[model samples]
Target: MKRLADHLQPGARVFVPGLCGEPTLLLRELAQDPERARGVRFVGVQFPGIGSADYLGLHPEAQQTAFFMSPSVRQGLRERRAELLSLDYPGIARHLQQCPPFDLAIGHFSPPDAEGWCSAGVCSDFLPIAWARAKRRVAQLNSSMPRTGSAFRVHLSELDAAIEADIPLTTFSEAAGGSETELRIGRLAAELVRDGDTLQFGIGSVPLALAGSLTSHRRLGLHTGMVSQAARALDEAGALDPDAPITTGVALGNASLYEWAGRHPNIRFADVRSTHDPTGLAALPRFVAINSAVEVDLFGQVNAERNDGALQAGSGGLPVFAQGALRSPGGRLLICMAATAKRGTLSRIVPSLGAQGLCTLPRHMADVFVTEHGVAQVRELGLDDRAEALIAIAAPEHRAGLEEAWRAIRNRL
Candidate 1:
């Protein structure tokens, strides 16, 4: 611990790995001796739901800068101890490249192989970029981390310091038995996907349900930002293409999925520059991106980042993937969400996205909108027709109110 603390100087900007790549042993050590990290600025891309650590809480003088907002750092934001970059995955990579170099970078990696090469394990998104930009590098070599293949590899000798720890890796397991509405929306979204389509989705009950609905499809390829436990089911059902490997930036699932990915030849982790790049995705045939949102308006605006005027999450890689899927020759962008919130009291299909809600994707980017009621294909439709299609899929109880609101909004236009 003394040797590791020697690298931490006051006012130094340090990069810490987030998600499944977080070094629990190292972070715990730092928290134990708060004086060591006093006045230090910690930066990383910690996600919501999966990331539980509050880096700003490590010390009274500690500051945190992040690209995403989560409950872990919301207090810091309010206290002015945290700053958000407000960028997507690709934007984050670019910022790390052009910004001032970090004083130190601490990352978790799998044990070196016979060739002395260490895999980035479950997270390869921003660690590689931060590693290159930091003046000094440290590696936490975890024996439990699955040694997945990726272009981002680190030699044990490259790191200035190496700490050996065999702690349990962080895991996020979706709850069993999704809600009835989620299953219905999943079935409708699955109907839009062909047998051989390449898929991109994130972590949620809807995606988990969608994976169950897709077991009968053949030769489905995955080029996604995060690979969940659903990938295993698809593989077991012979739904995924046997020849094509699963390309993702991170593997976030339960311990069983981690054990399955260990030294697995079919999984290839990639950096955000490749995983979230629109041009690369545009070339894939029949690309289908299934995403979710908090709400949508008749104007085709999608708000995935906020709920009731509060920042609940970040606008992750959705916009980038939406662009890619829209440009693909046979691609489809499916936004799946329940027709209403609060047990059908509040309509998610609103007449307009008011100032309280932050629009993650604007009106032009919308394509297929799915709900438990039905599917709304509005990519080629006009403003009036698009509103009609979306209203038809909204919850039946709210249909009358939505139509009345839309008429008033239409007159203004």
Candidate 2:
């Protein structure tokens, strides 16, 4: 640990991996000498295991860079004490292409096998991105990280430093608690799901609740872009089809989900090339892709990103599934969510999206909108027809408001 931190010069920038894959132990040791580490800049999605945002406060010049603003880093970024650099999914990879990179890139890696190459574990996707962009690669080797497959690896000979540690990573957002609305949405989502249907969804209450309800299904498969705690619970309940092609790009969820994924026979962790490949998912029979949306305008445009002026999340895996599900014969692409948020203060079935709303899936591609109220079948509908159907599916409290918006948009009155 001492030797690894020595690589840092004053005002050095360090790239840290996001999610549970953070290098906490290394950061803690460096935090000891507040003066030496104070001026250093940190970069990544969010600080995973780097404890005490207070450590970075030692120096006013200290800042963190993030592709997406996470709640953990939100305060720092908001106050201008830290900087938030917004980049889309593809942009994140492109940002890694810039030269004259960080002083060192740190990551938690699986111990090297007989070949002397260490696996990047859950995030070969991002690790490769960072490695290509980083000036030097330093890894904190841990046995806990599953020795998963990858295209390339960091070798002991090439690494600037290799420290040993058994530190855990952090989660950006915990699972939203299952509510009556979520459960009802889940029940509706389950009706659309059938046997041998390949599933793809992100981490949230909706996915978890839906997965938990699928115990009776058979030959169900998984080729999702991400997995959540509900997916893990389904796996434990013997609902997930283990023998099938269970693929994923990342697992962002609770501790149980992380523990369930570490080299579990059922979970075959793979890269984006295969997992998020639209062509590949389209080929699968009975493929059912479920995504969430922030708001749905009258035109059926799905806003999965942004809320007001702030960026809530990125457009991840939603378009991939939407396109692929359309291509797959007998497949369904469904967007499921509660009818409203803010304690029913506002409707998600909006007359118009907030200024920050980014249309992730266009109206033409969107298939179904399922809420506790009803399922709005708008995939093949015309503009006016779709608005009518969407309004019908909205929660009762919000339907009247949405109808007025629909009427004005259609009649121009």
Candidate 3:
């Protein structure tokens, strides 16, 4: 196991942390002199909101190959900062299990209990595959990581090196709900949603805002990657409509979502396979896949990956739904985000994605891009034209700069 330093080299394939399961301390070693680290590619499925700062964003020297698109990695890919490997959840696990062993893998775990077992902590979905195949396994021990029942814990003897840290583990929370901007995005996304449409709900307050307004709707269904309190509120309000089908692969909350699901019949949990089956999603009529983007550009590219070194918000079922939405005769795939973040100082709609923004949603597949200000249909526009329309939707304060930059360009016209 001490061969950890021997097997890795420039451009070596490394499976790094994932899905709120990153090793922040190991990342410090990774950030070592780029000259020595130049050829390493960190690969895994994690989201920006869940990963460490490096995965949220990566050092230029480390190339990346990911299964699910997260914010930080999306930023890098979009900006051509790094290479990306975009695949759905099934595709990710399939690759890990069937593909060649990786040079190294970074893992997280809780301390071994008296039973000589350690839980995969909060993320067990991909750990088993990574633990077995990766040539070298580095464990980052976090006492705070939840010891969930389904996780597969490894013993300390099995770990090659255990780096103990007192850092906070990641968890997703309801966005501070009921903002005027969120309400606006919610209403528009809701309008596109028709009666009896199967839905994919995402994190953030927009879902809550939209959930409240759906009380009058009927036969609506949910089969998503994650669910929040809104799902319960809708069920209790009789808006969930028991006669209809509802399913999910995962549920999350600050304890409220759990309490609501304990005895609920509507909430059925499934593994990644059934949850994100492209075929199953294709069968649903009038499917509406509503997801949020960090910031969308004129071309409708979506980057839902890394913010730090670790990934928090993996694509989960989003790509599968996006493809399925395209197949549905009347289906709609919407990427919704606030026009500005960071207290309105940043414009979510920019002429181009950031230097590190990766394209999670390829421009062609993107149907609608929505901000608090308004929605823009960029489905089939030229690059310049898409830029023009996107700028119009930018926060009122940032539009001028985008336009000036657009105008300065030398076009063939």
Candidate 4:
């Protein structure tokens, strides 16, 4: 048992595990004594609850550079103490590997096995690569972290410091079973999935609802970014391959799901490079990628990273996954979202996206669009036809306005 200071020097750039893999002890130490890390810069992605807030709140001088902004980090951004980077999921690994390597990579991990190997557990995102490239590596070996079957294992000999932490691993409840609107969108998206399809499910209620509607499908293979309770259910229903592992980049769920993951031998975790590479995903048979979006315009342009002018999340692996699904034989890319936002006042399906909207997936790459009203298969349609199809799936109240906007654009063209 050693303090983080014993292994880390002050004013260095450190990498902490994002999402559920955050090390409780390490973070608390930083938060409790920010001066210990006064000039240090912390870099990572989404923090579930107390991520960065404690440290940043206490030591505003300690800088933060996030790949994917969390709610807490967003607050820091508002306060002008943090900044977000624009990069794909796989690209995060590449960025960290560049010049002036990270001073220390700190996070949680499973205890060393008899063979002296420690697993990355629920997080396999960029940990392996970060550990390799980092000048120092510190890990909190927690008994509560599920030992997922990830290839990103570091031998005990590689660790600069091993702290035994008995804290509970963070858990997330399954997203509330979708709203009426989400259910409608889910049903339409679920119809696109076929028997023996290799699936990639994204985060958010739309994808969760779609998963809930997929129990009847047979032989679904998972090559996704996040493994949720839906994945566990699919595995139990015999919808997934018993031989081939459900390849994913991260695991996010409650304790029961964690237990299931620990017991299941077919769930394998890989890096973003392997899971999000379009070339690799295209090689899989019958691939189907289901992702959510904030807004999608008549052009089939997808905006998943921002809304109303402010950033919400990152580009993540949407582009690569969409491209991969499109290139796969018998593959389909389904973009699902509610037709309206702001409590039904705003139309998500508009003639053109807002000015701040970043095109995560371009029009030429879109495959299918799903909303509460219906599914729009407009991948090969003309621009006018695409607008018509998209409007058809928009909330009934907004369809007329969207049609008027579309006609105005067509007339000008």
Candidate 5:
């Protein structure tokens, strides 16, 4: 294979894989020839904490256009060298379909199977769409990548160039034990979940802790956007239904989980259109969507994207799953978070989301709200009653102040 830079041209719009599918070898090669990459534009959806590649820093004139904000792109965003497309998972797929064809699509894939097909492996989110729309396709073939059965695959003949490497896949390890507050919140949230429920959750400390709390449950099913180490624990504990497949867009975990998923018959890696589609999710029985947020107001509105007036993340698949849960029979949308942040000095359950806060999920979409103190079922409650329920679950120290704030807000109404 020729050098990765040889395939690139100035001002090219390159589609790079994100998350665990990131082609480090190709990126390193591109970074090595900074002058050649000038005016190059890198595009993809990078998740925070999972991806940390500064593509814009490769050259002073290099630019990036991404769907999600990450630490790697934050500097470029502030410097006006990067663009953040505020689109949900499904919307992103649509954008890619309608946007101008990319000059090149570079991806990391598992080695060819008996049929000469390479799997997208741990990250199949949107690469397939981009791959189809690109004029040229390049792949970094890694033997270390798990050949997941249900992941998207590309033919060896489809690639314009291929670079072989043996680098380890990126891994994410959640802390073994969470804080006391997280444990309490997890336990409280777990109490709302029942056997035979189909689960959908995002990545975070609370969800990990919730997994630990649900070890005793039985026959739970998973239809989530991202599958993490927590899914392995559920399967091992026999909490997950043996017959149902673990449907997810991506499998993000350590090496052991990857190895397990490679041979596991029940793990299915799907595309975003299927994983995040509301209609498909609503068809599943007892679909329970559990997600965490930065804060929740008495009205049950959620803010998961921003904090302290700064953008921290993207819209993601949360809203889509919430809609599914709401429409599904016997389904529930559980918004789980600690009642306080910043060492208990601030209350997460507030009187209202102020002008600065971005409401990621509106009040009606949240069926239940869980805090360390307790769970508030606010879906059927009116405004006044909803405020009281949320206030009751607030931290003991903040309960009184929250009640006072709610009362003032109520008087204005």
Candidate 6:
């Protein structure tokens, strides 16, 4: 701990792996004595519920910056104790590529293999890139983190220091079985999927529900940004390709899934450069991309990142998948969401996005819109037809108002 603290000086910036790769023990030790590393900044994205934000709250000199928002860090940003940087999923690798030499890079990794290589395990998102940019690299060799034969491997000799910790890897519980609306949306979205389709399922109740609905499909292939428990289930059910590997940039699931991934030779992890590359994704035959959004306007603009004016999550890999699916030979991009939000009071299918609405996926890039009511194939549709199709999927209570709003905006356009 003394040696770790000694590496940090006032105003030094350190890079910490977020998601399932956060080194809990190392971070806890650093938080214990903030005086030793005053004015130090921790940079990362989507930190799970660790005390990283709490440390920022307690120590005025310490700062935390994130490229994506998680619950804990989002709270800190709201209080003006932290800052947020805007970047997409693939952009994460580019951000690390451009980062000035970092003071230290800390993360969790699997135990060294026979060849003295440690895999980033559940998270291979940007650790390799961060490692190249950091002046020092420290890792917690956790037995719990499953090694998925990721290309993001580092030799044991490369680490400046290694700490052994056997803590359980962080798990994101599945959303309580999707609501009636979500289930209906899932069914609608799943109907678009066919056999031999390579799939990209985003994280949410809707996607999980869609995965459940896909149990009967055959020969499905996975090439996604994040592999969830649902993807494992599909593979277990023999729905996925028997010989082809399930490719993902990150894994976010439970202990059982982690162990399963470790033993499964078909679970192959790659970096975002390969996973989210537009040209590479287009080459996959019959790709199907299903993702949820916070809102979608009549113009087919998808907003997955904001609520009213508040930041919800980052753009993530949705843009990449959407464009990729559109370019695939027989691909379909389904942007799904419940018809309403705020306890079913407000329509998620709006006339136009609110002032702060972010077009995570542009109107032309979208293919299908799914909700509880029905599915709307809006790709290549004109403004009036697109509005009509989208409004038809809105909740019955909000349909009339949405139509009126569209009519007013239609004339203006």
Best by TM-score: 1
**Model 1 lDDT vs. the true structure?**
0.88
**lDDT tens digits, residue span 326-379, model 5:** 999999999888888898898888889987689999987868999888989989
lDDT of each: 0.88, 0.72, 0.67, 0.79, 0.86, 0.81
Give the clashing pairs for model 1.
Answer: none
Model 1's number of clashes is 0
Per-model TM-score, in order, reads 0.98, 0.86, 0.63, 0.95, 0.97, 0.94
Residue 403 in candidate 4 has what lDDT? 92
What shift in Å separates residue 104 of candidate 4 from its native position after superposition?
A: 0.8
How well is each residue in 1-413 modelled by candidate 2, as lDDT tens digits? 35556666667777776555666666676667555565677776542232234434555566666655456556676667676555544455566666357778887788988989887766544556666667888888887676765454678888878987776655545456588888889988888888778888777678877876776777788887666676666676777676875787667654555656765766666545567677888898878888888888878889877777566766655777788899999889899988888888878888866566878787788788898998988888988788889888887888888887778877873
Q: On residues 1-413, what C-alpha lDDT tens digit does candidate 3 reach at each position?
A: 33233445776777765545566555555455334346577676665455454533444566777655456566777767565555668777777888889877767766668876666644555666767898877676767555545325677777667666645555457765688888988887777777777888766688888887776777788877666677766777766658775666445565445445434655665545666777887777877888887767665677765332344455656778798887876778888888887898877776656666766677888787778778777777887778877887789999998887667652533
Each prediction's Cα RMSD?
1.2, 3.3, 7.8, 1.9, 1.3, 2.2
Q: Which candidate's lDDT is highest?
A: 1
Ranking by lDDT: 1, 5, 6, 4, 2, 3
User: Model 4: per-residue lDDT, tens digit, 176-200?
Assistant: 8778888888888888899889999
The residue-by-residue lDDT of candidate 6 on 192-305, one tens digit each, is 999889999866688878888999999889989888888887877889889887888777767787788777888888778888899999998888888889999999989988
Error of 1 at 31 (Å): 3.1
* lDDT score for residue 89 of model 6: 71
Which candidate, 4 or 6, would have the higher lDDT against the true structure?
A: 6
- The global Cα lDDT (0 to 1) of model 4 is 0.79
Model 6 TM-score is 0.94
Model 6's alpha-carbon lDDT is 0.81
Model 3: ten consecutive residues of lowest lDDT: 1-10
Question: Which residue pairs does candidate 4 place in steric collision?
Answer: none
Which window of ten consecutive residues has the lowest lDDT sum in model 2? 46-55
Which residue ranges in model 1 land beyond 4 Å of their true spot? 1-6
lDDT (tens digit, per residue) of candidate 1 on 16-47: 88888887876777768778878888988888
In candidate 5, stretches whose alpha carbon ends up further than 4 angstroms from where it belongs are none
